[model samples]
Target: MQHAIAILDSGVGGLTVVKEIMRQLPQEKIIYFGDTARSPYGPRPADEVRLFTRQIVDYLAQFAPKMIVIACNTATAVALDDIRRHVGIPVVGVIHPGARAAIKSTRSGMIGVIGTEGTIRSGAYEQALKRISPGLQVFSLACPRLAPFVERGLFGADEAEDVVRSSLEPIMNVPMDCLILGCTHYPFLADAIGQVMGPGVKLISSADETAREVSAILYHKGLLSESADIPLHQFFCSGDPALFKQIAQTWLSEQISITPVIWQVPNIV
Candidate 1:
């Protein structure tokens, strides 16, 4: 039987990874769990983050995914190790994949990563990059408001555009060959980010690299979906159904009929 992958994130940000997975590996089925109710995990405490992440992973495991992707940067920073220890399945996080990709893309040997405060403070990306290539220089900043902007469907609005530009100003003057979209909601502001950073600096989406990693791991484990036929994908949100579906359709640029799935927190635990 073909194995499905479970993708858990604090919110819609993980869709960036999911979208890439669908495009790159058409036959693989995916179960996406978005903890919209407790999103913007960037500011939460480590223990709280870990508990929340574990709940999502445990909930998704009900589907018996061959592996799970902790797609939120904050969750990956705080809870990845816990998830790996608790779950025997291959659990992958976005940090290493993104850091590796940045290393490969940087010409100036300098890279900038922006995510929620939790992600930046954890220093996971910085540590991961050094592990991959000790010589690479990494600069990271936190953007707590970015996720909220995207979540509220304000990504392209004038205020959001201004926010993107202003937030990027600090890193713009730095000499870097590439920037990592460390947070998943970030791809939604790609145009604005690219504009501020200029075309000279390539923006690397962790989602894209993470998806590629998913392809390799599944292939190596002999767990890649066997059926040549296209697989069904499901999306569940722990928040407003109409809003989730609306934002999903806009961000994905594809129609998504997402039915609301009321996820009980304590039940998963």
Candidate 2:
């Protein structure tokens, strides 16, 4: 089943997962959808988030993707099942992989998670961690503005350092040995996060783990693409297409065409 893969997020964060997928499965074509118009799905109601995610899955399904990767932890926690059912495709989300990786990397059983308000409030990462190992301690922090700040290209700036440090101070002060970047956009601030977290802690980006799971699922389902010609990936955003494209190239390490859409068919599979 050599076919294109669809990856979705509320904003630019999902591109981190897409980057990993591109590196791991270079032959696969991708169609990435970022609902930037409704960016920061974290604070919205769960049902609304589910509906928004379902809509994107339906839109991407029209492309006949073999799999749909939910690259947003907030969405994964809130809507993975809805999107999967709506699209009827091999759907994957970031939560489980990130949870597993955090558990694996933690020696003190203390795992810290930083994500959007939605993800932190959802407690999906905590549930996943506890479900795997009930004894593991989980700390969650919400960095609501962090995503947009990164999207605005302020992450690498010196001024952003203080915000990053303050935002993560609580988590850093904790005894956690592993920190899960529960939001895709959080990786853009990895350097700042790492500096605040100190060298002893291992930072886990769900993007890498999530991409690995995507590859595994595609391989097992026999949907892995085989084109040696190098597949082309297209990006689309509901808001500023040019800005979205710029952010995509910045994070994914490649430039691609991005178009603006009024809306992608909003429905479940």
Candidate 3:
């Protein structure tokens, strides 16, 4: 059996990263786990998020994947280094890739970052951005409501625009040239977010950059799949399978056409 790439998130938010992976590296197999029962890791305590991340990583270990991608920004901010210490395989997180993308896209040094409370509180993006370019002006906001909204599969509703507008009101007038959808889940609401942020601010999603990083790491390590045949992807969620399936199918269909195999794991909680 070919070694699969393991990706885990707090909920459907990580599907954004999965879509990018499927597009950029079609031959690679994916094993994804969504802790939908505990959908928003954003507001949780850092220690708790780290514990949940460790549990999920331990669960995915049975598959013996070649790499593990911590696709949730909240989890990435808190648990990334801990997971790396616990696992033997390569570990990737969405934070640095996102910071890198925002740096490249910004014409003005002012960049805005919106994420869950935990991500913004951790100061991870700000640190990552400053480490790359010392003089960057970074604005960070915690949009605590957005992730839960997307997790419920309501990102397409008319009310989504209103919610996005209200959530982003604080940063709307900032003269930033680009905004990082700091949470992976934010991409699900990209349409509403883009409309609110206007044309001048580029919306940078770590999904694309993270996918590129995954491909680069695999290539350098000689772990890229050599098979030409399409791979079957496995998805597992801890909450409502029907809802998770509905959102997954809707979002993934827009990117890559696939009939995903989804399972509900009740023991993770």
Highest-lDDT candidate: 3
> Which ten-residue region of model 3 has the weakest summed lDDT?
254-263
lDDT of each: 0.85, 0.82, 0.93
By TM-score, who's the top model here?
3
lDDT, candidate 1, at 103: 84
Model 1 lDDT per residue over 1-269, tens place: 56688998888889889888878887788888888888778899999999999888877877889999999989999999999999999998998898989888888899999989999999999999988788888888888878888888788788877899888878889888899998988998898899889989999999999999999998898888879866767788777667777777776665243333434444542
Candidate 2, residue 205: Cα displacement in angstroms equals 0.2
Sort by TM-score, top down from the best: 3, 1, 2
Indicate the residue-level lDDT of 264 in model 3.
Answer: 72
**Candidate 2 lowest-lDDT run of ten:** 258-267
User: Per-residue alpha-carbon lDDT of model 2 for 1-269, expressed as tens digits?
Assistant: 34688889988888888888878877788888888878878789999998888778767766888888999988999988777667667889999999988877888998888998888898898889999899988888998878878777677689787989878777667888889999998888889888888998899999999998888888898787767765767777777676776676667555333222323423332
Question: Measured by C-alpha RMSD in angstroms, how accurate is candidate 3?
Answer: 1.1
Off by over 4 Å in 3: 255-257
Could you give the C-alpha RMSD of every candidate to the true structure, in order shown? 2.1, 3.0, 1.1
For all predicted structures, in order, the TM-scores are: 0.94, 0.92, 0.97
Which portions of model 1 miss their true places by more than 4 Å? Answer: 255-269
